[model samples]
Target: MSHLTLIEQSPDPEESKRDGQRHSIADRLRSMGQVRAGAFLLLGATLAALAWANFAHGSYDGFWDTHLTLSVGDLQLDFTLHALVNDALMAIFFFSVGLEVRREFTIGELTTWSRAVVPVVAALAGLTLPALLFVLVSAGSGYEQAWGIVISTDTAFLVGALALIGPKAPGRLRVFLLALAVVDDIGALSIIAIVYTDNFNPAPLLIAAVGLTAVYFTRYLQSARGLVYGSLAVVVWLAFLASGVHPTLAGVAIALLVPVYRPERREVEHALELARTFRQSPSSEYARAAANSLRESISINERLQSSTAPYIAYVVLPLFALANAGVQLNAEILASAARSQVTWGIIVGLVVGKMVGVFGSTALMRLLRVGEFGPGLTLDRLAGGGALSGIGFTISLFIVALAIDDEAVQNEARVGVLIASIIAFLLGAVIFRISDRLHPSEEIGRTLLRPVDPTRDHIFGPVDAPFTLVEYGDFQCGFCLKATGSVEEVHRELGGRLRYVWRHAPLTRFHPNALAAAEAAEAAGRQGKFFEFERSLFSDQEHQLPSHIIRRAQELGLDIERFERDLRSPAVAARVRDDMLDAEAMDITAVPTFFVNGKRHTGPYDAQSLIRALEQSAQEPQPGSSA
Candidate 1:
């Protein structure tokens, strides 16, 4: 579940139209599984910690206990190695989380209340039940306050777990989980800020408030943002540390104040202007101005999140696992933990409580007509996701450190965290297997991924047409061009009874101009000439150049400036890419792949064959009956 969209890769203006869309490289990179790789790194760290603690318990303890000091001309800061990783470096981790939360609320999963309510309510239930379970199980254990441990979920590991489980086209479920996890993080952070803090100093908080005020206004500044934000962030962190607040809170505070916005059209156009000027007269001055313009066009929140996510995932998180996951397991500690209420409380709260809390609340919400889940997010899949949510690692261990001061108690809690994570993953795997069996998603390519909507789909005929034919076609394909004629013949014979829908499945690897042409159709669609542009591109397929595409738009009486702007917009690129990805997921590797009433057409796609199929499908149970 990620709002992480593929980065926009504009087709080169200098290349021949046949050079095609270059997103195949990006698709290859995406297939390499960055999240899966990062998850493995974290798991490796956790395992290494276990091995070190069990093999050389003294070194594991002694190393983490080593005191480190930072001095800046009489301003001295001190921390044990373990504290430095958890308290200082993890502030950056929290900062990244804060960045995601801000982006998500503004533009990602939680942008609208209607779209967000189901997951938001489910997240609250997930948080509440787990903590209550922990409190009840740990009653009279002298550490019921450690309820925060069960309230959180390790998002990194949760995502990785989903990837490992490999559900078919889990796009909707991923979106729901992303929204739920964002709320879950917010709940965990609240618990940390409100429940665990001590000393309660208001004096330094005034200073922190002042620093935060400065941060609020830093958005208006045009340069040295890195230096400014870094300096101010340190000041704020120090202020919070002195105020007896967990200093990581400063990260959230700073991030919330940092501006987040879509790149302005004017700003992007101006950046392009600077870029053109630089190309005409290559100089350091022009280069710097263009660079700043490009950077300024995008918001700092996005830039900061993208830049830091790698380090946070690869370095900071692994270091956190190393410092916190080193529970020295032995006969005595194992026996003690087995009997410890805190241990069982954590496991039950996570492995059992989280599942019931998340999935049960979501199901109840749907039953009560509170909100809707996107298609494909069945209760069965949610059961699996809820089980995965129980893998509470990072924040769980962090809370263990803060809430339990006794070494023995700390060890017991850590043991519980580790065991719970493993059980949650295994249990989630089994649940997903059962879910997959029941749903039978294995027939992916045999049917449509999502039903066509009149608002979102490109169509030609009545919205309530009795017969529908959907084509996943490439603009540059000769076979697709042939199929279009057959489709026209079928439409002529069928009249308003048929609605033909076009979706992109651009074979960019072989037909470079295909992706660009598809995007051009979308761009033209903004001005009511999509089908006209499609016919023009197909009629003169060999002339499918950047110049040709623009000329076609002009000949169709499209506003040149508006068309150009729309052509390069991320929305346009994402639209084409979404179709491409959808096609890829359904294994639609070739052009002219047709789905007649949600079932893939076989044998031939000639007018006669398509007509017969549509006729037959009219009588069969139809999965893609139009609105």
Candidate 2:
């Protein structure tokens, strides 16, 4: 036999193989308890971000504002204060936004004209009104630059606020808000491109234009590759950056140009033709001849789009948020922004203007007979809901920093954002309270904001195991090694009744190996050794066992040959990629997270918490029925 077929490899199995695998009661309780702990941890991180920006390291308030230079010999990119954040980190955010835009325009809620119009109109109003208001108020020499500040809405902050409201929000209202947001985002992009670009260079603009055209013309490329788009996007961003237009706009341009529609007709016809050829002969030689032709005709467009979306969403967006959202503030800056009209205009524009513009535009859309109006909501409720648009803190702050070069302008803008956001929240709360008191309706339940269900297909399998435990862990995590004890305990305690499912919540910023680790584990699972391989993975903790783990798989009596070959397969990488998509859909932000019997858990579990969860699960009925 050839050397290629002789290597020992780990077995590949499905997650179903581990179904009903028993686990300890202690692991169950710990997993359950950590759900709340995870929430606290998430909250703590948010608070820490705010506090760190506002208080600690007051001396370096201008650290992020300081100029940084990146140069390649004669080629250099220099930016200062907030431009770097908006143009650099925000480019990744824009990239994510671009992906979302493509998804929506292609096949999402915005696929149809009726679905798209209301939001587009509402987005227009949301964009135009606040910007006009800001411009009107801050009519100084550089005041016009602040126009984009009001036009942009922070999707993260808006979505986060809606999540906090839980059951209080209606489904129609949520849909309306989402549509309006899409519109608002488009408006923001326009403002950045049209209003923000100062001293534009024609050469770079021309190059960017050509790059965009290339993406559009090659839209039908059967072998359309993400790397092509990525590389071109980088080039466009660089050109735009050098051209004096914000680099982030490159993300939008590249995104718009990338075609989302698949060449399905050709693909299907080709596949059929290949199938016909295969049916004619059973010989390996014939099979190879037919398969090669089919493979050649096979387009990677679907795979390309699928692969790109998750990278932009989970990897790029989060990293951008982490890098750019760390704003430093102090008493002086806060006070300055409190008193500055330009700052106040941005604050008022985001908080008051956003609410008014968003809600007003949405209301107008309803009146204009454009899309359906939100049910169970009156004008008062709509107006109140609009106040929540003040949650544009992130995008507002980002734009404010970009709009002004002066420290005073930026500080004042930040203050306005803070104040307006708080006020908006209060206004929204009051409206919700009044709406609830006057016309109580349970039609819109609290589950609307819950994480998207992952078990719809029994995607993992039925949890008939005695100990039902779900883990929110990244495969490349070291701390999860300590977590193995809890997993083992639950299996031991509740044999056959326990089901453990692994989830991907990789932290790309902290650990680079996480994505690969997840793929490896999934690949191992394909060969029936997920649990064993996962144990080996967690055992190392620091995640230093990629090659060694493969070597160890050989020792574990695995088919090291097939296993090693499959480990590097795109299918394996795609599995990890799929998990990442699911993770994003489910709103998982951190790693080492767990959920037992529908309850969330975080970090490593000790004995006591584990037992408590299992005991509690014992009292509760099985989770199949709707709660």
Candidate 3:
């Protein structure tokens, strides 16, 4: 049988040009239509909400306080227009927040310890100090529930404002402001999950756990359907809502549990090669024909990473904002809020607290020898960014609704939010202006990592030989999936002599499921069905893996009970950690990194060269042998 080897596509001008063209089309569409549509929807929603609240109150007696009920026999939910927005619509907002939080941690800025610490610490201080300030002024008041209102920062509003200034603002300032806003969002979500939740309920809590477990396994089994995930997410949200945890947490929970990898890059290339060769060959073959069946699989694999931002940024986030960002303030309410301690506290906390907290924390970190400034950033610039971090509109509003129930108190908090946002904006602008004048320009440095090597090609040996190979791959990487088949072929051909050790080296800046998948595989390995579980990791439709892999083990007559036990065990997670550390130490930047007979080869390999390398190794004399 002629062996098939896979070669991962190195980035070429042709592919880059194609990608750039597609991006241009996407950008044009977004600018010409989506942006305008989104803006109109936002403005319309805001106006509708305001009109609904104020018109009902003014036009009719007791309209704002009128009790609205949704009942199914004995089941009833009773609330006002405000409560409906706060408790129900706001839950979706929080869910979106949760998704953003989960994304940041899993694949964005919060993924690495070093890269994560700066923003996290800044966010922590931004949340903590403002909350402390609010409590200091309003500890025994009716507005104590509104503590989280000051801890948020609105990236969209701030960025939009910056865009209005156009070329007058430096690009570096924009990047800095955006970073601060993203970190502020992280802080805001953490506060919601930790500070807002009431005491937990046992039954609903269990239900939430079960739903989460189901999502995790669904991704593992690779039989994930989007509707199923969406349905389960609803269940999880309802459970959390009933359990006294905010329902929004469920969105993030679902996002985290969704699988993201499309097998290894090697496997895709191998399949493609087999398909191409089989099409050219005259002989009838079963495996070759089966391989040829997956010809369109490569294109499908590319779509995996491309789907994340479009869904989250444009769809989920806008819907959430439309649902949550509305409040009506009549003259009386505004006058009352101006004098209310709750309102004043929120205003002060946001305007003063966030700036002081972020700037102080950054300064403290530098003084304590914890971290140095990032390239293209300085203390002055960071301080200016901190001032802007006080624009805590979206999350702050969500938290305020959760915190205070009284009309007077809510109005007071809203006023505080408005004033604080204005103050923060002006102050941030001033700081930025001063910093720009003081320091005109800065050179941006490259992020720490070497470019991928192109010289080495041989990675895996003969598929039918008895040889053990191990791979460390990132799920977000296209190349890693391309390398999958060579490892599989080695396992198939070598059998017992070839044991592939799978490890997690997820680059959190990209793939959310990489670490989880690695952990899941390790968890399954404990039950001696590692290969089966690994296959499901690739074949399953979900972003992660199915929760039913253990169930499959049960059907295979393995110890299903033991497998379930191991899935939750810390050892599995620990093994994944060890692999992550190994990757870090080896300076392996790209995914699908290989180790064969103590030799390291990065990227995917073709079959012919792999066979040649293995044959040569086999024939070479040992150091101790007399030839």
CA lDDT of each prediction against the hidden true structure: 0.83, 0.58, 0.57
Task: Tell me the tens digit of each residue's lDDT in model 1 across 436-543.
Answer: 787664475677766778877888889889898998887877778888899999999999999989988776656666777888899999888888898998898897
Off by over 4 Å in 1: 1-32, 72-74, 265-286, 366-372, 439-442, 452-459, 473-486, 503-592, 603-608
lDDT (0-100) at residue 373 of candidate 1?
A: 66
**Preferred candidate (lDDT higher): 2 or 3:** 2
Taking all chains together, each candidate's TM-score versus the true structure is 0.84, 0.55, 0.55
Better of 1 and 2 by lDDT: 1
Best by lDDT: 1
Which pairs of residues clash in candidate 1, taking residues 3 or more apart in a chain or in different chains? 20-512
lDDT tens digits, residue span 269-307, model 3:
456566667767745794556454453343221233244
As for TM-score, the candidate ahead, 1 or 2, is: 1
